[model samples]
Target: MMTEKQLTDALRRRDEAAFRELILRFQPITARVIFKITGDKEETPDLVQEVFVSIWEQVKNFREEASLSTWIYQLSTNKARNHLKWKKLRTGFRLSWQSEQAQPPAGMNHSLNMALEMFERKDDENAITMALQQLPHNQRTAFVLSKSEGLSNPEIAAIMKLSVSSVESLNFRARQNLVKILLPYYNNKKS
Candidate 1:
């Protein structure tokens, strides 16, 4: 039941138990940050592991000026950015992985495929994800942290290394752009 500061101190001293606690406490947030950025569930587990590994090596260098969670977030976001860069260079396109959904029955006709796609499960979430993918990386991250992860502007600013006003601006633009992107989809559904 150690506090985050005590746990960080133990981790700085290279305690295995502290590292384990760190994993248990922070892995989910780290995973979510990377996964939202990359949109790849298959890639997230490995990326989370890599984030912890980097943190393990760098814990001794932590200056404690920021909260431990902030540091972890900064590390996770940086790693995710690097991963996206490397992936884009290798693949020449961003891979937006869809959520796991029920497979269509085999041997469907083209019309049936179109009809089924029109009524697909998770359509709302998927459409929102598509819009999110369309946003620039900073805007997307700022939006997700603000809206999805329920983080405050100051926390997001720390994670993004931006001023709080900049974070606010990013969130503002993200919302406006998302409304523009998703308005047609909702309108189409009503037709």
Candidate 2:
């Protein structure tokens, strides 16, 4: 197996094999992160491709101050955020958490019950996704990386270009916001 440094060096040199290895290694996590962040299945595949293309184009400029995975995570989060901004602009709709009734994509499984850990049912996943979408971008990113990806606060901070304390704060605020956004939905369901 190639070391990360070897892979990064190869990628910087534009080696096709290194690029393919990078995709094979990172694609699943990248897709999951993008899906969780954007809450859009249809756009995810295209967005993932865009991320790899970006990595290819930008590898030369990578300073290697952080791990390659951390750098990739940062790039993916930025891409997802930009996608949301463009989508909101194109549709002239606010990307608010107060969404109309939405359905979780088909085939949601126990594994996807990452952060909430309580969403055994599809409806619960839908509610979580909607509530997650409602958070501010930094909060949402921090929450997803911490809870869903199980990354550490320091790692998240590196990816987000924020302090560890900031990541913790974002996560705390994200949890608070998710509860506020989801409470009414669960109450209505119980009624």
Candidate 3:
């Protein structure tokens, strides 16, 4: 198997096999990153493809100062953010497209699914989603990166181009905001 550098070199030379190999190598990671940011499984697949297309166009300009994974992560982050912004501008509200189809088996609890269906009927999920959308961009990104993608602070920092300390600070604030917003629901559920 070729190293990342060799693969990148081949891609730069416009080798189709190398491009396919690169897509195979990075698609899952890119998908995860985009999905975490958007919380929209239906949208992630197309967005992941867009990220790779952007990478193909921009690979010649890559400076190699950071690992290729890091570069791709950063690119994925930017694309996801742009997608969110574009969606907001186009729709006049941020539309979430999270489909049950992509949820982890562990997260697909029957009771929770029933509860979510009830909440949907009551439009409560929209409230929670709106509250999450109210969070600051960096805090939202940090929270999603940590919780949804299971990325560590160091990894999020690398992706966001922030210091580790900054990532931690963002996550702390994000959690605080989430707790405040979700407290009523949590209390009701407990009761």
Task: Give the candidate number with the greatest lDDT.
Answer: 2
**Candidate No. with top TM-score:** 2
Q: Give every collision pair in model 2.
A: none
Ranked by lDDT, top first: 2, 1, 3
lDDT of each: 0.77, 0.81, 0.74
TM-scores across all candidates? 0.82, 0.84, 0.76
Which regions of candidate 1 fall more than 4 Å away from where they truly are? 94-125
Candidate 1 on 46-130: residue-level lDDT in tens?
Answer: 9999999998999889999999999998998888878877887898863322211312122123223333354355564577666
- Tens digits of per-residue lDDT, candidate 2, 20-91, equal 999999999899999999999999999999999999999999999999999999889999999999998899
Q: Superposing all C-alpha atoms, what RMSD in Å does each candidate have to the true structure?
A: 8.5, 7.8, 8.7
For model 3, what is the alpha-carbon lDDT of residue 170?
84
> Per-residue alpha-carbon lDDT of model 3 for 1-191, expressed as tens digits?
78989988988998989989889898888887787677677999899989999888999999898888889988888988888888878888623324323332332243234444455476645544544554556777788778877889998898898899989988887677566556654666678
Worst 10 residues of 2 by lDDT: 103-112
Candidate 2 residue 52 Cα shift, in angstroms, is 0.5
Candidate 2: stretches off by over 4 Å: 96-125
Superposition-based RMSD of candidate 2 using all C-alpha atoms, in angstroms: 7.8
